[model samples]
Target: MKLLKERIMRDGKCFEGGILKVDSFINHQMDPILMKSIAVEFVRRFASTDINKIITIEASGIAPAIMTGYLLELPVVFAKKKKPVTMENMLTTTVYSFTKNRNYDICVSKDFLRKGDHVLFIDDFLANGNAAKGIIDLVNQAGATLAGMGFIIEKAFQHGGEYLRNAGVRVESLAIIDSLDNCEIKIR
Candidate 1:
């Protein structure tokens, strides 16, 4: 987590409107070593939880989730933003993308997510908790138990972290940005 915070300070780009672009390393173009380190940290953080499957939204969350799943030796399932034609008996939910500024119908196959599954949700970022809420809905629809949620970066100023925590969700964020006001990155 310390490594992540330092990397964010060095390479993360701060834009107006509370946007922190970490594409240089974290999301778009990835650093495998750093990602491995992050996966290790996540494994350590949630070692005690009973997790059978790892869930993440497609696109950015895939890398970290895969790494974490590999380390944990657990199956990883990513919810597709666009439901494929072949996908059947799927659990679907709507999620608003903070970055894209649009709603996406995210879904997963019922074969992948099912009742009695203890799942851990992983994602690239958490700002408004919309995606997280969507994941929760999908998990609930499947009758699966959401064990925890992991995030690479969390904008604390947005209060998503507070909302999830207050709702009794175990949320872990490696780098928490206290503020991204006036194109400045402040880490908490």
Candidate 2:
């Protein structure tokens, strides 16, 4: 976690609307070594549990989820941002993106998730927690058990982490930004 915090301080940028632009190493462009380290941490964090699968939203969360699945030796499933014509049997839910400033639907095939699965949700960032909530809904619809949720970065200034925790969701975040005041990203 210290390594992640140091990397964020070195490479992260603070944008408008409290956005921490970590695209250089996280969402957009990626650092495989860094991701692997993060994955190892996730594996350690959830090692005692019986995790059958890893679920994440599309685009940004894919990389971390894949690395986590590989390390955990579990299958990884992601929710698609757009439903394709080829896919008919799917479970869908709406998630609001604070960064994008819009609400959109995310979809996943019903076949991938089952009633008894212990799913661990992985993502690159956690701000509004809507996307995670939507993914949780998909798991709920399948009657699957949610083992926990993990994130590379969490905007603690926002209510995302607290909301999920209050709901009894086990949330693990490597770096939590408590504040972004004075053009500085403060972490806890």
lDDT of each: 0.93, 0.92
Screening candidate 1 with a backbone cut-off below 3 angstroms (N, C-alpha, C), the clashing residue pairs are none
Flag regions of model 1 displaced more than 4 Å. none
By summed lDDT, which 10 consecutive residues of candidate 2 come out lowest? 14-23
- Predicted structure 1: lDDT: 0.93
Minimum summed lDDT over a 10-residue window in model 1 is located at 95-104
Q: How accurate is candidate 2 locally (lDDT)?
A: 0.92
lDDT for 187 (candidate 2): 87
What does the lDDT read for residue 19 in candidate 1?
86
Candidate 2: stretches off by over 4 Å: none
Residues 47-66, model 2: lDDT tens digits: 88889999998898999999
TM-scores, all models, native as reference: 0.98, 0.98
Clash count for candidate 2 is 0
